[model samples]
Target: MSAPGEKVTIARKQKKLTQTELGDNVGTSRDIIGKYERDETKPSIEVAAKIADVLDCSLDYLIKDINPEDELAKKIEQLSPINKEYVMAVIEAFEAKEKLQGKR
Candidate 1:
């Protein structure tokens, strides 16, 4: 498990977000984002929460090595009923197509 800084960097990259973009989302500057990534500075709880929100991740994932995908699933679980139904339909369609192609 990596530290928060490494987690931040990983999540940011996974989301294909630039440091400037992430900082902008969190109401900070690119330099501050760099400092956080380098572990030279720690963000306050509010800032951390904002970062997590922008990154579509949980604070646990950011600070405690929890699986980020699990956090993503949690977010999906919170989707509106119609969106959830659409997502499930897409998943079922993909699965059916895969089965037809003999792919797991």
Candidate 2:
């Protein structure tokens, strides 16, 4: 497990949440979250629980130093449509632009 401070910072970043977003959910200022992330301050147990709940992560995972982004990515993938046409369109546009430049 990482030191408590490192764990918190890593969890926050893995959630892709800004300090301001986290603080908004946890009823604190972003500065407080920043301080926690920087190891300049520590949250009480109650605050830690709140943080875990708001971040939608298990306290054990947060404390035990698991990589949270994998779960987050899975959740995002579940929510997002697999739009092959959209992806292919973007790729085709990029190739067309490249060819146009070659012609110049």
Candidate 3:
């Protein structure tokens, strides 16, 4: 619980949500959310679950000590070349669609 504050802060920032916004999503007040971020208080299991859902992060990520970016980078690096090409193709298709729409 002591260590979770920093990591939770990081996750919340990455999601670009303010304490008030996050609290709104979890049905809590900004003050309580601030306490969680400051490590002054630990959230109940239910509140934690709601926070995880609102933040689009795993409960483990908010509670346990883990470097989320490291794991994400590793997973991204593991994508196959063919899969990478497919992703690029999708991006190109979207760009083409946008250009076509803009010309209309």
Candidate 4:
């Protein structure tokens, strides 16, 4: 297993879900979510599985040393064609912005 907290935080944010929102979906509280993100506490496997589902990621992504890009590609592959196009446009815009700032 890798740094679970970091993976949870990244996957949660990638889904554009607030900790509170994620907690609500997972039948937990925002404080618990915060604790998980800060690594102050660990969620049970069941809770972790729920978190993964709500975040649209897999337990493997959260608990193993998996490449994040692969997880994201998997999610993107499941999107509708129009939604995929939107994602590509967003990626292009972000890349363009990064280029303008000499970040890439």
Give the RMSD in angstroms, all C-alphas superposed, for model 1.
5.2
Q: What is the lDDT of every predicted structure here?
A: 0.92, 0.77, 0.85, 0.91
Comparison by TM-score, 2 against 3, better one: 3
Candidate number with the higher lDDT (3 or 4): 4
Q: Candidate 2: lDDT over CA atoms?
A: 0.77
Off by over 4 Å in 1: 67-104
TM-score of 3: 0.63
* lDDT for 25 (candidate 4): 99
Best candidate according to lDDT: 1
Model 4, range 33-63, lDDT digits (tens) per residue?
9999999999999999999899988888788
TM-scores of all models? 0.64, 0.54, 0.63, 0.63
Off by over 4 Å in 4: 68-104
Better model by TM-score, 1 or 2? 1
- lDDT of candidate 3 at residue 30, scale 0 to 100: 93
- Report the Cα RMSD per candidate: 5.2, 7.9, 6.3, 5.9
Question: Poorest 10 consecutive residues of model 4 by lDDT?
Answer: 59-68
Query: lDDT of candidate 4?
Result: 0.91
Candidate 2 stretches with Cα past 4 Å from truth are 63-104
Which has the greatest TM-score? 1
Model 1, 1-104: lDDT tens digits are: 68899999989999999999999999999999999999999999999999999999888778786666786699889999999999889989999999999998
Ranking by lDDT: 1, 4, 3, 2
